[model samples]
Target chain A: DAMVIQNPRYQVTQFGKPVTLSCSQTLNHNVMYWYQQKSSQAPKLLFHYYDKDFNNEADTPDNFQSRRPNTSFCFLDIRSPGLGDAAMYLCATSRDLGLETQYFGPGTRLLVL
Target chain B: GESVGLHLPTLSVQEGDNSIINCAYSNSASDYFIWYKQESGKGPQFIIDIRSNMDKRQGQRVTVLLNKTVKHLSLQIAATQPGDSAVYFCAENEDTGFQKLVFGTGTRLLVSP
Candidate 1:
Protein backbone atom coordinates (compact mmCIF):
# COMPACT_ATOMS: atom_id res chain seq x y z
CA ASP A 1 0.00 0.00 0.00
CA ALA A 2 1.20 3.49 -0.77
CA MET A 3 1.73 5.16 2.58
CA VAL A 4 3.54 7.87 4.48
CA ILE A 5 6.74 6.88 6.29
CA GLN A 6 8.61 8.64 9.07
CA ASN A 7 12.15 7.93 10.18
CA PRO A 8 13.25 7.34 13.76
CA ARG A 9 10.02 6.10 15.24
CA TYR A 10 11.50 7.07 18.59
CA GLN A 11 13.78 10.06 19.03
CA VAL A 12 15.68 11.22 22.10
CA THR A 13 17.47 14.52 22.37
CA GLN A 14 19.05 16.63 25.04
CA PHE A 15 18.06 20.16 25.95
CA GLY A 16 19.44 22.81 23.61
CA LYS A 17 20.38 20.15 21.09
CA PRO A 18 19.23 20.10 17.52
CA VAL A 19 17.09 17.30 16.15
CA THR A 20 15.68 16.37 12.79
CA LEU A 21 12.79 14.15 11.77
CA SER A 22 12.21 12.97 8.22
CA CYS A 23 9.13 11.92 6.31
CA SER A 24 8.78 10.38 2.89
CA GLN A 25 5.69 9.30 1.06
CA THR A 26 5.10 6.85 -1.71
CA LEU A 27 1.68 8.39 -2.33
CA ASN A 28 3.31 11.34 -4.13
CA HIS A 29 0.76 13.73 -2.62
CA ASN A 30 1.51 17.38 -3.21
CA VAL A 31 0.78 18.54 0.32
CA MET A 32 2.91 17.38 3.25
CA TYR A 33 2.15 18.37 6.82
CA TRP A 34 4.04 18.26 10.10
CA TYR A 35 2.15 18.16 13.38
CA GLN A 36 3.22 18.06 17.01
CA GLN A 37 1.06 16.11 19.41
CA LYS A 38 1.50 15.91 23.15
CA SER A 39 0.11 13.19 25.34
CA SER A 40 -3.66 12.92 24.86
CA GLN A 41 -3.72 16.27 23.06
CA ALA A 42 -4.52 17.37 19.57
CA PRO A 43 -1.93 17.23 16.88
CA LYS A 44 -0.96 20.85 16.33
CA LEU A 45 0.02 21.84 12.82
CA LEU A 46 3.44 23.38 12.79
CA PHE A 47 3.68 23.87 9.05
CA HIS A 48 3.09 22.22 5.71
CA TYR A 49 4.51 22.10 2.21
CA TYR A 50 2.37 22.39 -0.86
CA ASP A 51 4.44 21.08 -3.73
CA LYS A 52 7.63 22.72 -2.47
CA ASP A 53 5.85 25.85 -1.25
CA PHE A 54 6.15 26.08 2.51
CA ASN A 55 3.44 27.49 4.78
CA ASN A 56 4.04 28.04 8.43
CA GLU A 57 1.45 28.58 11.09
CA ALA A 58 1.22 32.06 12.59
CA ASP A 59 1.84 30.93 16.14
CA THR A 60 4.44 28.32 15.29
CA PRO A 61 7.58 29.03 17.24
CA ASP A 62 10.81 30.10 15.56
CA ASN A 63 12.52 27.03 16.92
CA PHE A 64 10.54 24.84 14.59
CA GLN A 65 11.21 24.69 10.88
CA SER A 66 10.37 22.42 7.96
CA ARG A 67 11.81 21.74 4.52
CA ARG A 68 10.49 19.82 1.59
CA PRO A 69 13.12 19.02 -0.94
CA ASN A 70 10.71 17.36 -3.33
CA THR A 71 7.23 16.03 -3.63
CA SER A 72 8.05 12.83 -1.81
CA PHE A 73 10.28 14.01 1.01
CA CYS A 74 10.02 16.51 3.88
CA PHE A 75 12.01 17.20 6.99
CA LEU A 76 11.21 18.80 10.33
CA ASP A 77 13.98 20.50 12.23
CA ILE A 78 14.02 21.67 15.80
CA ARG A 79 16.77 24.24 16.32
CA SER A 80 17.05 23.82 20.05
CA PRO A 81 15.07 21.14 21.78
CA GLY A 82 13.56 21.86 25.17
CA LEU A 83 11.97 19.52 27.66
CA GLY A 84 8.61 20.91 26.67
CA ASP A 85 9.33 20.07 23.04
CA ALA A 86 8.93 16.40 23.73
CA ALA A 87 6.01 15.13 21.70
CA MET A 88 5.01 12.93 18.82
CA TYR A 89 5.85 14.36 15.42
CA LEU A 90 3.38 13.28 12.82
CA CYS A 91 3.79 13.49 9.05
CA ALA A 92 0.85 13.53 6.72
CA THR A 93 0.23 13.88 3.01
CA SER A 94 -2.79 14.83 0.95
CA ARG A 95 -3.68 15.61 -2.61
CA ASP A 96 -3.37 19.19 -3.87
CA LEU A 97 -6.60 20.09 -5.62
CA GLY A 98 -9.45 19.90 -3.12
CA LEU A 99 -10.07 18.62 0.38
CA GLU A 100 -8.74 15.09 0.24
CA THR A 101 -8.22 12.52 2.92
CA GLN A 102 -4.80 12.74 4.53
CA TYR A 103 -2.52 9.73 4.94
CA PHE A 104 -0.44 9.61 8.10
CA GLY A 105 2.79 7.93 9.12
CA PRO A 106 3.39 5.92 12.25
CA GLY A 107 4.89 9.07 13.84
CA THR A 108 8.15 9.86 15.59
CA ARG A 109 8.01 10.23 19.36
CA LEU A 110 10.57 12.78 20.52
CA LEU A 111 11.76 12.69 24.08
CA VAL A 112 13.73 15.76 25.10
CA LEU A 113 15.73 15.52 28.27
CA GLY B 1 -8.27 32.94 16.26
CA GLU B 2 -9.55 30.05 14.21
CA SER B 3 -9.70 26.79 16.16
CA VAL B 4 -11.42 23.43 16.39
CA GLY B 5 -12.41 22.16 19.82
CA LEU B 6 -14.09 19.23 21.54
CA HIS B 7 -16.81 19.28 24.15
CA LEU B 8 -15.41 16.49 26.31
CA PRO B 9 -11.90 15.34 27.07
CA THR B 10 -12.79 11.75 27.85
CA LEU B 11 -15.57 9.20 27.49
CA SER B 12 -16.16 5.72 28.93
CA VAL B 13 -18.13 3.11 27.04
CA GLN B 14 -18.89 -0.53 27.55
CA GLU B 15 -17.98 -3.09 24.98
CA GLY B 16 -20.58 -3.47 22.22
CA ASP B 17 -22.09 -0.05 23.03
CA ASN B 18 -22.11 2.97 20.82
CA SER B 19 -19.89 6.03 21.26
CA ILE B 20 -20.46 9.65 20.47
CA ILE B 21 -17.85 12.37 20.30
CA ASN B 22 -18.64 16.04 19.88
CA CYS B 23 -16.65 18.96 18.52
CA ALA B 24 -17.09 22.64 17.76
CA TYR B 25 -15.40 24.96 15.32
CA SER B 26 -15.20 28.74 15.30
CA ASN B 27 -14.62 29.08 11.58
CA SER B 28 -17.86 29.37 9.66
CA ALA B 29 -15.99 29.19 6.39
CA SER B 30 -14.89 25.68 7.16
CA ASP B 31 -16.50 23.53 4.50
CA TYR B 32 -14.94 20.15 5.16
CA PHE B 33 -14.77 18.22 8.41
CA ILE B 34 -13.06 14.97 9.33
CA TRP B 35 -12.84 12.54 12.20
CA TYR B 36 -9.62 10.77 13.13
CA LYS B 37 -8.73 8.00 15.56
CA GLN B 38 -5.32 7.74 17.16
CA GLU B 39 -3.98 4.77 19.02
CA SER B 40 -1.44 4.90 21.82
CA GLY B 41 1.73 4.56 19.73
CA LYS B 42 0.45 5.25 16.26
CA GLY B 43 -0.62 8.22 14.18
CA PRO B 44 -4.21 9.22 13.54
CA GLN B 45 -6.26 7.22 11.08
CA PHE B 46 -9.11 8.81 9.16
CA ILE B 47 -12.52 7.55 10.16
CA ILE B 48 -15.02 9.62 8.20
CA ASP B 49 -15.75 13.07 6.80
CA ILE B 50 -18.66 15.43 6.23
CA ARG B 51 -18.95 18.51 4.11
CA SER B 52 -20.73 21.71 5.06
CA ASN B 53 -23.18 21.32 2.20
CA MET B 54 -24.35 18.04 3.74
CA ASP B 55 -25.62 17.41 7.23
CA LYS B 56 -24.38 13.87 7.59
CA ARG B 57 -22.21 11.15 6.14
CA GLN B 58 -21.64 7.59 7.18
CA GLY B 59 -19.10 4.84 6.77
CA GLN B 60 -18.77 1.34 8.09
CA ARG B 61 -19.85 1.53 11.71
CA VAL B 62 -19.21 5.30 11.77
CA THR B 63 -21.35 8.35 11.17
CA VAL B 64 -20.52 12.04 11.07
CA LEU B 65 -23.01 14.84 11.65
CA LEU B 66 -22.38 18.45 10.89
CA ASN B 67 -24.40 21.37 12.26
CA LYS B 68 -23.17 24.40 10.40
CA THR B 69 -25.59 26.69 12.17
CA VAL B 70 -24.17 25.89 15.57
CA LYS B 71 -20.69 25.14 14.22
CA HIS B 72 -20.83 21.73 15.81
CA LEU B 73 -19.84 18.26 14.59
CA SER B 74 -20.30 14.83 16.01
CA LEU B 75 -19.00 11.32 15.37
CA GLN B 76 -20.94 8.20 16.25
CA ILE B 77 -19.39 4.77 16.46
CA ALA B 78 -21.64 1.73 16.44
CA ALA B 79 -20.95 -1.55 18.24
CA THR B 80 -17.86 -0.27 19.92
CA GLN B 81 -15.16 -2.69 20.94
CA PRO B 82 -12.03 -2.64 23.04
CA GLY B 83 -10.02 -1.96 19.90
CA ASP B 84 -12.08 1.23 19.55
CA SER B 85 -10.39 2.67 22.61
CA ALA B 86 -8.40 5.61 21.35
CA VAL B 87 -8.32 9.36 21.03
CA TYR B 88 -10.73 10.92 18.59
CA PHE B 89 -10.30 14.32 16.97
CA CYS B 90 -12.52 16.44 14.80
CA ALA B 91 -10.82 18.54 12.17
CA GLU B 92 -12.03 21.34 9.94
CA ASN B 93 -10.84 22.73 6.64
CA GLU B 94 -11.34 26.34 5.69
CA ASP B 95 -13.23 26.62 2.44
CA THR B 96 -11.94 29.98 1.36
CA GLY B 97 -8.27 30.05 2.19
CA PHE B 98 -5.28 27.74 2.58
CA GLN B 99 -7.64 24.87 3.25
CA LYS B 100 -5.53 23.26 5.91
CA LEU B 101 -7.35 20.98 8.30
CA VAL B 102 -7.28 22.26 11.88
CA PHE B 103 -7.61 19.58 14.55
CA GLY B 104 -9.47 19.68 17.83
CA THR B 105 -7.97 18.93 21.22
CA GLY B 106 -9.33 15.34 20.98
CA THR B 107 -11.46 13.11 23.20
CA ARG B 108 -10.13 9.91 24.71
CA LEU B 109 -12.52 6.99 24.51
CA LEU B 110 -12.16 4.17 26.97
CA VAL B 111 -13.90 0.89 26.25
CA SER B 112 -14.58 -1.18 29.33
CA PRO B 113 -15.32 -4.85 29.07
Candidate 2:
Protein backbone atom coordinates (compact mmCIF):
# COMPACT_ATOMS: atom_id res chain seq x y z
CA ASP A 1 0.00 0.00 0.00
CA ALA A 2 1.17 3.48 -0.70
CA MET A 3 1.46 4.99 2.74
CA VAL A 4 3.49 7.19 5.02
CA ILE A 5 6.16 5.37 7.02
CA GLN A 6 7.88 6.50 10.22
CA ASN A 7 10.91 4.95 11.82
CA PRO A 8 11.81 4.05 15.40
CA ARG A 9 8.32 3.77 16.85
CA TYR A 10 9.89 4.52 20.22
CA GLN A 11 12.92 6.67 20.96
CA VAL A 12 14.76 7.52 24.16
CA THR A 13 16.97 10.57 24.44
CA GLN A 14 18.81 12.27 27.25
CA PHE A 15 18.16 15.85 28.28
CA GLY A 16 19.89 18.36 26.03
CA LYS A 17 20.70 15.63 23.53
CA PRO A 18 19.75 15.91 19.90
CA VAL A 19 17.50 13.37 18.22
CA THR A 20 16.07 12.97 14.77
CA LEU A 21 12.88 11.29 13.60
CA SER A 22 12.43 10.14 10.04
CA CYS A 23 9.47 9.82 7.73
CA SER A 24 9.21 8.47 4.22
CA GLN A 25 6.29 8.01 1.93
CA THR A 26 5.53 5.67 -0.91
CA LEU A 27 2.65 7.89 -1.94
CA ASN A 28 5.02 10.41 -3.52
CA HIS A 29 2.99 13.28 -2.15
CA ASN A 30 4.11 16.85 -2.72
CA VAL A 31 3.57 18.06 0.81
CA MET A 32 5.04 16.64 4.03
CA TYR A 33 4.25 17.73 7.58
CA TRP A 34 5.61 17.28 11.09
CA TYR A 35 3.45 17.41 14.18
CA GLN A 36 3.91 16.93 17.91
CA GLN A 37 1.24 15.18 19.90
CA LYS A 38 1.11 14.69 23.64
CA SER A 39 -1.22 12.33 25.44
CA SER A 40 -4.89 13.11 24.94
CA GLN A 41 -4.05 16.18 22.84
CA ALA A 42 -4.43 16.95 19.21
CA PRO A 43 -1.50 16.77 16.88
CA LYS A 44 0.16 20.18 16.67
CA LEU A 45 1.79 21.21 13.45
CA LEU A 46 5.41 22.17 13.85
CA PHE A 47 6.33 22.61 10.20
CA HIS A 48 5.70 21.34 6.72
CA TYR A 49 7.37 21.26 3.33
CA TYR A 50 5.76 21.99 0.03
CA ASP A 51 8.03 20.48 -2.58
CA LYS A 52 11.09 21.73 -0.72
CA ASP A 53 9.58 24.98 0.48
CA PHE A 54 9.75 24.69 4.24
CA ASN A 55 7.02 26.43 6.19
CA ASN A 56 7.35 26.49 9.94
CA GLU A 57 4.55 27.34 12.28
CA ALA A 58 5.04 30.81 13.78
CA ASP A 59 4.91 29.60 17.36
CA THR A 60 7.09 26.55 16.78
CA PRO A 61 10.18 26.78 18.92
CA ASP A 62 13.54 27.28 17.22
CA ASN A 63 14.76 24.05 18.78
CA PHE A 64 12.57 22.07 16.41
CA GLN A 65 13.62 21.82 12.78
CA SER A 66 12.61 19.79 9.76
CA ARG A 67 14.25 18.87 6.51
CA ARG A 68 12.92 17.27 3.38
CA PRO A 69 15.99 15.90 1.72
CA ASN A 70 14.00 14.57 -1.20
CA THR A 71 10.48 14.09 -2.39
CA SER A 72 9.90 10.91 -0.42
CA PHE A 73 11.87 11.57 2.76
CA CYS A 74 11.53 14.10 5.57
CA PHE A 75 13.20 14.35 8.93
CA LEU A 76 12.33 16.14 12.17
CA ASP A 77 15.24 17.23 14.31
CA ILE A 78 15.15 18.31 17.90
CA ARG A 79 18.28 20.25 18.73
CA SER A 80 17.98 19.88 22.48
CA PRO A 81 15.54 17.36 23.83
CA GLY A 82 13.79 18.38 27.01
CA LEU A 83 11.31 16.66 29.28
CA GLY A 84 8.59 18.88 27.93
CA ASP A 85 9.51 17.84 24.39
CA ALA A 86 8.80 14.19 25.03
CA ALA A 87 5.80 13.21 22.94
CA MET A 88 4.72 11.41 19.82
CA TYR A 89 6.09 12.96 16.67
CA LEU A 90 3.89 12.39 13.68
CA CYS A 91 4.60 12.75 9.98
CA ALA A 92 1.98 13.20 7.33
CA THR A 93 1.69 13.87 3.63
CA SER A 94 -0.85 15.10 1.14
CA ARG A 95 -1.01 15.17 -2.62
CA ASP A 96 -1.11 18.98 -2.70
CA LEU A 97 -1.56 21.92 -0.40
CA GLY A 98 -5.25 22.64 -0.90
CA LEU A 99 -8.17 20.84 0.68
CA GLU A 100 -6.59 17.40 0.34
CA THR A 101 -6.68 14.69 2.97
CA GLN A 102 -3.41 14.01 4.73
CA TYR A 103 -2.14 10.49 5.30
CA PHE A 104 -0.27 9.97 8.57
CA GLY A 105 2.33 7.51 9.69
CA PRO A 106 2.44 5.61 12.96
CA GLY A 107 4.15 8.23 15.09
CA THR A 108 7.53 8.02 16.75
CA ARG A 109 7.25 8.26 20.51
CA LEU A 110 10.06 10.29 22.03
CA LEU A 111 11.02 10.05 25.66
CA VAL A 112 13.52 12.41 27.20
CA LEU A 113 15.22 11.68 30.47
CA GLY B 1 -6.40 26.89 17.31
CA GLU B 2 -6.70 26.29 20.98
CA SER B 3 -5.41 22.97 22.24
CA VAL B 4 -7.79 20.26 21.15
CA GLY B 5 -9.36 19.40 24.49
CA LEU B 6 -6.68 18.50 26.98
CA HIS B 7 -8.98 15.81 28.33
CA LEU B 8 -10.44 13.27 25.94
CA PRO B 9 -14.11 12.49 26.24
CA THR B 10 -15.04 8.84 25.75
CA LEU B 11 -18.14 7.15 24.36
CA SER B 12 -18.79 3.53 25.15
CA VAL B 13 -21.13 1.36 23.12
CA GLN B 14 -21.91 -2.31 22.63
CA GLU B 15 -20.65 -4.11 19.59
CA GLY B 16 -23.03 -4.16 16.63
CA ASP B 17 -24.55 -0.90 17.80
CA ASN B 18 -24.30 2.25 15.79
CA SER B 19 -21.77 4.85 16.90
CA ILE B 20 -21.81 8.58 16.45
CA ILE B 21 -18.91 10.87 17.24
CA ASN B 22 -19.33 14.65 17.28
CA CYS B 23 -16.97 17.58 16.92
CA ALA B 24 -17.28 21.34 17.03
CA TYR B 25 -14.92 23.07 14.68
CA SER B 26 -13.41 26.51 15.29
CA ASN B 27 -13.31 28.08 11.83
CA SER B 28 -16.43 28.97 9.89
CA ALA B 29 -14.43 29.53 6.74
CA SER B 30 -13.16 25.99 6.70
CA ASP B 31 -14.16 24.54 3.34
CA TYR B 32 -13.76 20.87 3.99
CA PHE B 33 -14.05 18.37 6.84
CA ILE B 34 -12.58 14.93 7.44
CA TRP B 35 -12.81 12.22 10.07
CA TYR B 36 -9.90 10.08 11.21
CA LYS B 37 -9.45 7.06 13.47
CA GLN B 38 -6.35 6.62 15.54
CA GLU B 39 -5.68 3.36 17.30
CA SER B 40 -3.53 3.14 20.39
CA GLY B 41 0.06 4.13 19.66
CA LYS B 42 -0.64 4.56 15.99
CA GLY B 43 -1.28 7.25 13.41
CA PRO B 44 -4.59 8.68 12.34
CA GLN B 45 -6.40 6.78 9.62
CA PHE B 46 -8.70 8.56 7.21
CA ILE B 47 -12.30 7.48 7.58
CA ILE B 48 -14.61 9.83 5.70
CA ASP B 49 -14.83 13.40 4.46
CA ILE B 50 -17.46 15.99 3.65
CA ARG B 51 -17.10 19.27 1.83
CA SER B 52 -18.73 22.47 2.90
CA ASN B 53 -20.85 22.31 -0.21
CA MET B 54 -22.16 18.91 0.77
CA ASP B 55 -24.00 18.00 3.95
CA LYS B 56 -23.02 14.31 3.98
CA ARG B 57 -20.57 11.83 2.54
CA GLN B 58 -20.29 8.11 3.16
CA GLY B 59 -17.57 5.54 3.01
CA GLN B 60 -17.76 1.74 3.24
CA ARG B 61 -19.24 1.69 6.71
CA VAL B 62 -18.73 5.21 7.95
CA THR B 63 -20.44 8.51 7.17
CA VAL B 64 -19.40 12.08 7.68
CA LEU B 65 -21.77 14.97 8.13
CA LEU B 66 -20.81 18.59 7.92
CA ASN B 67 -22.84 21.57 9.12
CA LYS B 68 -21.25 24.78 8.00
CA THR B 69 -23.96 26.80 9.67
CA VAL B 70 -23.08 25.49 13.10
CA LYS B 71 -19.45 24.68 12.39
CA HIS B 72 -20.07 21.11 13.41
CA LEU B 73 -18.93 17.81 11.96
CA SER B 74 -19.80 14.25 12.85
CA LEU B 75 -18.90 10.67 12.02
CA GLN B 76 -21.39 7.86 12.09
CA ILE B 77 -20.40 4.23 11.97
CA ALA B 78 -22.91 1.46 11.36
CA ALA B 79 -22.61 -1.85 13.15
CA THR B 80 -19.78 -0.54 15.22
CA GLN B 81 -17.43 -3.32 16.21
CA PRO B 82 -14.69 -3.73 18.77
CA GLY B 83 -12.17 -2.93 16.05
CA ASP B 84 -13.85 0.45 15.75
CA SER B 85 -12.60 1.42 19.16
CA ALA B 86 -10.17 4.29 18.83
CA VAL B 87 -9.75 8.02 19.18
CA TYR B 88 -11.78 9.72 16.51
CA PHE B 89 -10.86 13.19 15.34
CA CYS B 90 -12.54 15.70 13.07
CA ALA B 91 -10.41 18.03 11.01
CA GLU B 92 -11.25 21.11 9.02
CA ASN B 93 -9.39 21.88 5.87
CA GLU B 94 -8.48 25.53 6.14
CA ASP B 95 -6.51 27.57 3.66
CA THR B 96 -4.62 30.74 4.51
CA GLY B 97 -2.21 30.89 1.56
CA PHE B 98 -0.77 27.74 3.14
CA GLN B 99 -3.11 24.82 3.74
CA LYS B 100 -3.52 22.71 6.89
CA LEU B 101 -5.95 20.47 8.68
CA VAL B 102 -7.24 22.04 11.88
CA PHE B 103 -8.26 19.16 14.11
CA GLY B 104 -10.96 19.36 16.71
CA THR B 105 -10.76 17.86 20.18
CA GLY B 106 -10.96 14.11 19.61
CA THR B 107 -13.38 11.66 21.18
CA ARG B 108 -12.42 8.16 22.25
CA LEU B 109 -14.81 5.43 21.16
CA LEU B 110 -15.02 2.19 23.08
CA VAL B 111 -16.98 -0.74 21.68
CA SER B 112 -17.54 -3.74 23.91
CA PRO B 113 -18.48 -7.08 22.55
- Compared with the true structure, all predictions reach lDDT values of 0.89, 0.91
Weakest ten-residue segment in model 2 chain A by summed lDDT: A37-46
| Model 1 bad stretches (over 4 Å) | B1-8
Q: List chain B TM-scores, each candidate.
A: 0.90, 0.94
lDDT of 1: 0.89
Q: What tens digits encode model 2's per-residue C-alpha lDDT throughout A17-38?
A: 9999999999999999999999
**What does candidate 2's lDDT look like per residue over B1-113, in tens digits?**
74645679999999999999999998888888888899999999988888888998888988888887888888999999999999998888888777678888899999999
Q: Please, what are the lDDT tens digits per residue for candidate 1 over residues B1-113?
A: 33344454889999999999999886898878889999899999988988889999989999999998999999999999999999898888866467878787788899999
CA shift at B4, candidate 2, in angstroms? 4.7
Predicted model with the maximum TM-score: 2
Candidate 1 structure quality by residue, lDDT tens digits, A1-113: 89999999999999999999999999989999999887766888889888978889988999999988888899999999999999999999998846777878999999998
TM-score against native, each model: 0.93, 0.98
